[model samples]
Structure formats: structure tokens, C-alpha cells
Target: MRRWHALLWLLGLLALAGCTRMDLAYRNLDTLIPWTLDDYLDMNREQKHWFEDRLAEHLRWHCQTQLPGYLPWLDRFEQGVAERSLDDRALRTLTDEAEQAAAAVAVQITPSAVELLQQLNDQQVSDLKVAFAKDIAKRHAEKVAPPLEEQIQKRAGNMIKRLEPWLGDLHPQQLAAVQSWARQLGEHDRIALEARARWQRALLEALAHRREPGFDTRVAQLLQRRDSLWPAAYKEERARSEAAARQLTLELLRLSDADQRGQLIERLQHLRERFASLRCLN
Candidate 1:
């Protein structure tokens, strides 16, 4: 269920220009996430009720506690854009803040995940393994089977789509720069697939011993300290990819024109208002 953490990034991205879309999606997330989980492990009535109740509690905690915190980050980002003072250090700081916020949420939810996993029957565990295998195979086919050049092109295209909401259309030079950045980003699909397989393998191993003492501690560490479980090679490759991305983002910001800067500030401002509105409704 750590995959559910990706929702935070999605919410952040969509907040820039699609708050209405994000709001609707966020409201339905409790429902949508259960549907996704049911694909992997079908829960019995009691477990389903427990999960729904826990999810509701987590959502309320996130809205009441976490959403308000984003205001300061947005304010800083807006000021940086307005003053043309954004730099790599500032970007790193922002990234760290976001990670900390997500980690807090992960900590809050880890106990619930452990409780639910510990209750899974053998048949459900088998179903989970099947689901993991199916997901890995699908990802390998889609992400790894592509030719290298095609993969780079697709990666750059996806980055453009994400950036365009705040940056608007990229200039020809910017597009070329993005393509170059994509090429230099070390081969990620293979390493990422390996990392996912490794994590799932570890999870299944942990789940199989669910009745053992300290099982909850082990599972909590697995979920929150996941980086420790990554293959060293994968860790290195992922770090390289992330550093390349950060460099690319900083360069893009440095090259942004007045209109692009204004657009970014406006988008951030709009996101601030949206967060405020959501908190007030809470």
C-alpha cells in the first residue's frame, strides 16, 4: 500500500493548475484506493470496515494538519519566483520539506497497514503474490521493453506534460534541453523494476512470518525505511537520476522568462488558495 503515497505527488502536481480536478479526485481517493487494494487482496467485512475507518481518520488528519503546512512552502516558492532567486539549494530544501510531510503521513498509517496485513489469510497472501507478479510483468513490458531512444522520448514528453501546467509551453531550446536531460538520466526502468521486485519479495517474506514476535516492528521498518532495502546498485542509479532531474529543474527555472515566472507564481498562489479552502471546509 506504499504505492498510495504517490497520491501526494499527484495532488501536488495537479494543484498547480487543476485544483478543481484534484479536489474531486482527492475527495474520491478513499474509495479509489480501496478499489485498487481489492485488486491485490480482497478483504472480509470486518477488515473492510476497519480499513475504511482508518482511511477516513488519515484523510482528516492530513487535511487538518498537513495541508496547512504547505502554505509556507508555497509562499517561499512564490517569493523565489517573483524575485528570480530560486536556486538548487532552495529546491533541495523544498524537496526535503515535502518528503518530511509524506513521511509523517507514512508513520501515521504504518500501524494500520500492519494490522491489516497481519490479519490476511493464506489465500489472500497468495493472491497478493499473484497481483505483485502481474504488476511487475506489466511494468517490465511497458517500461523496460521499449527501445532506449523511445524510452528517453517518452520520459521527456511526460516531464513536459508535468512542467507545462506552471511553465506553459517550452521553447524549442528548452525542449531540446529536456531531451538532453532525459538522455543523461541513467537507465532507470531496469533498476526501478529490480527495486520494486526486491521490495515486494521482502514484503512477502515479512508477511509469511506475520505471527512472529516483532512482526509489526519489521513491517513498519519495511514500509518507512524502504530505502535501506533497495539494492545498492539501484540506490546509486536512482540517486543519479534524481540529481539529474533536480539539475534540469534548476536550469529550467534559471531560463524562465517573465511570463513563465508570472505563471508559476500565479499557479502557486492559486494552489495556496485551494489549500486554504480545503482546510476551511475541514
Candidate 2:
């Protein structure tokens, strides 16, 4: 019973962590474009929820579950993080452990993603790979277009306008204060808009002049910063959590009878194949 309780607690914690990771990932995805905070926030409540839930579910199933299997040593590393009195070295050790765990999980899961597609017939799998590649290219194109940002901003402005009348019952002073804040925000937004416009113009000018070196370098730097900096912290945290989860899964796998283990392996193989195919396209 105690073990069961511990398992439930771990799962709950994992679910929360998975949700947080999903939110961070989606926010980063949007940030990869020139879109504003308001534009992302202006998504309908249901749409936002769906995005969060979908990614969370995917992470829980693909990342969270498989992580434990690959990195069984994470349990001790995670326990160190939970302790309030851990020193810097201990923390550093935990971070290193997490990095290794996450890398292992990523490597393991990526290949399995390909197997997932194999569960489909050969033709269906081929179609899926093509479709996945096309979708990724479409998303990449959207990210590169400043016009999408402008369109999102325009939609957000319209939403704010539509909401203003509904919020008009406040005191005159309150309304004035709110309007002042809005104006200041709008000014800041305009600066960002101008910057994006300049970037777009520079890209076009670079293209016309065949001056690819500087432009390509700048883009490469931006992408490098994103890859090196942003995900590291989250990756560390995810590694710790996944390590704990992996420990749990190892125990579960151990207790499972041979037939059950076989079934689990088959399912895992399918998931891995699908994920691999997606990565190949990306």
C-alpha cells in the first residue's frame, strides 16, 4: 500500500511537470516567430487549453514514460534536488545527471518514433512521413514570415477594442489609468513592430544584393542561442523528473510477467517508430 501511494504521488507530480514543460515548449514555439505576447495570449481560451493539453499528453506518454526506462539512475539525482540543503556541487551533479538522462531519453525515443509509423502498413507509413515533413515545412515558413505576426497583432488589437466597451463601467480615474497603461503598452509594441519591419526589410535587401554572409550569420546566431540557452534549464528539470519516473517504470517492468512485458515492448516500439519518422522529417 505504501508503495502504491508513492507511485500515485510520483505520477501526479510527473503529470504536473509534464504540463509545465508543455506550456514552456509551446511558448517557446511561438517566440521562435516575431509574434507578440498579446497575440499568443489572445488565442481563444479553448484553443489555448487544447494546445496545452495536447502537448502535455504527448510529453507524458512519449517523454515521461520512456525516460524512466532509459535512465534508471535518476531516482537518486531527483531526491537530491528535493532536499532543501543541497550544496552547489550536489546541484551541479544533479544538473549533469539530468543532461545525460535527457540526452539518453531523446536518443532512445527518437528512434522509436520511426517504429511507430511501421505499425501502419508500409504505404500508410510512407504517406505519414511525407505528410509530417510537409507540415513541418509549412510551420517553418510561417515562422519566417513577418506578415503572420502583423496579422496576429491586428487580430489582437481588434479583440482589445471589442472588449473595451464591456469594461467601460469602471470609475473615470480607473478608466483613465487603464487607458494610460494601454497606450504605453501600445508604444512598446510599436517599437517591436518597427524592429521586425526593419529585420524583414534587411532580409529582402540582403537577398537583392546577394549579401548572404551577414544575414545568415545573424540567423544562425539566433538559432544557436535558442538551442543552447533556452531549453537547458527546462531540460535539466525534466531530466530529474524523468529519472525518477524511469526508476518507477523499471520496477513496474520487473514485476510484469513475460507476456505483459512483450506487449509493452511492442507498444513502445510503435511509439518510437512514429517519433523517429517525425524527427527524420524535421
Candidate 3:
């Protein structure tokens, strides 16, 4: 199902606030998903129309049913920030919550994804493989070929940019903290690249047998059990990176000034209000 977009939107609801582009991405996700999906497999007119209908259903379901539940979590986060209690444990709990939310969305969308998979002809499947190869090459060149030091620097810069809106201009020590955390998680590009290849290979294999009697069940299992399919090394590295990131976030929050905290609280409040306004209780 390529559940990253749903997962990202769900997770984004947990922490981020003021990125207009991200907000637009969620608002226009139906269009964006098709555009992104086209990179892997282009759909014919009939399939595209089916996809659009299913996407609209998903969007409406998400907005009307799923989004409202996030309000409580957002309130808890805002309260955590207000009380200066967003520590490592709290962060881990939030991560679990977000993962569960994403999993729920994945389960909901699996049937539609299976239907789409059944529609793919041989040429489309070949095109999908070609797309995967192209993506792997592009990612390798962009993320892997860069020198280690450069990658660290670039990652640190991106972290700073993402945080600056909420935290304002960071001090030297704060920037150093980001750099240190990034350096600690060094060279995950290969792991991610390999993981992508494995996922795509699995997808291709599943497509190859799409005509089997239990194809729907197989596809559902593939999408819903995506984490279980991950290589153990990838899981371990991902966990380590997540823990380090949590520690870094807590440290940064501890280092932030009152003004920065005030700004963050304001942003959180704005997001909470925005989310609350979208409740379609009918």
C-alpha cells in the first residue's frame, strides 16, 4: 500500500505545527499519492478512477473518523511541553501511539491496495520494477555517495531548519547537540537502500502470484505486517536511531529558553485548534 504517506501524516500530527507545505500535503494527499504512486506503477484510466474513488473514501474516513482522535494526544503533548515533561519516556510512548495510528490506517487501506494490485497488467509490473531500480539508483547517488562528514553536516542543517520555526535560532551548543546525534547515527543510507530493495522485491513477488486463490489475504498480510518483514539489522538500527533521536529531542527541549517554549506552545495550540475544527461529528 506504500503506507509511508499515511504514516507520515499521522506522525506529523504528533509533533509538527507550522510547515505550510506539510499541511498542504495532507490536505491534497489524494492528488499527491497518485503522483507518487505513478513513479512506481502508472495506472490506466479505469484504474485511476477507481483509485481516486478509494482515495476520496480514505480521506473522508481519515478526516472524519481518525483525525478527531488525535486531539487528545495533541492535548497531552501540549500539556507535556507546558509542564516541561516531554522526556524520553514520554517521547517513546508518543512514538508507540503514532505507530499504532499508522498501523490502523494501513489495515484500513489494504483492501483497496489489493484491488489495485489485481488490476496491474504485466507491463505495469515491469514498469514498477524499472521504477524501483531508478529510485534505488537515485537514492544511492543522493544519500550514499555523499561523504560521511558532508552527510552529517547536511542532516544537522536539516534538523535545525525543521526545529527553528518552533525553537527560534538555536545556540552553538544546541547545534552541536544536533550534529552529535546525527554523527552517532552515521551511515544508515545503505541500510535504508537495502531495505527498500527488499520491500520492492517482496512486492514484485507478491504481484507475480497475484492470481493465486488467496492473493487478497497475501497482499493484506504483506501490507499490514510490513514491520515483521524488515531485516533484523534494519530493525535494530532503526530502534537505535529512534532512541538517540528521542534523547536529542529531550536535550534540546531542556536547553530551550522560555521564549522558545512560549513559541512552541503557541504553535501547538494553533495546530490543536486547526485539528479540532476539522471534526466531522455527523
Q: What's the C-alpha lDDT at position 6 in model 2?
A: 16
Which digits, one per residue and each the tens of the lDDT, describe model 2 over residues 1-282? Answer: 011011112222231132133223333332211211122123346544554554344445544454344233333433333332344444345445544544443343332222221223444434534544554445444433446445446434543343233222333443343343333333333333334344334323333323333544443332222233324444454445445433322333333344543443343344334433442133
Every candidate's lDDT: 0.72, 0.35, 0.73
**Ten residues in sequence with the least summed lDDT for candidate 1:** 12-21
What TM-score, over all chains together, does every model reach?
0.88, 0.24, 0.90
Q: What residue runs in model 2 are displaced by over 4 Å at the alpha carbon?
A: 1-19, 22-98, 107-117, 147-282
* Model 1 per-residue lDDT tens digits across residues 21-124: 34344555453232126656778999888877887787787777776787787788778778878777877777677667656766877788888888899999
Name the runs in model 1 displaced over 4 angstroms: 1-3, 10-36, 279-282
Give, for candidate 3, the lowest lDDT window spanning 10 residues. 12-21
Best-to-worst order by lDDT is 3, 1, 2
Candidate 3 local lDDT, 1-282, one digit each (tens): 333343444363333322332344445545323212655776899998887788878878877776777778778877888899887788778878767766777788888888889888999988988988998899888878899888888878877888888779988888888889879889877787788788888888888988788888877767777676789989988788778777787787788889988988797688667767753644
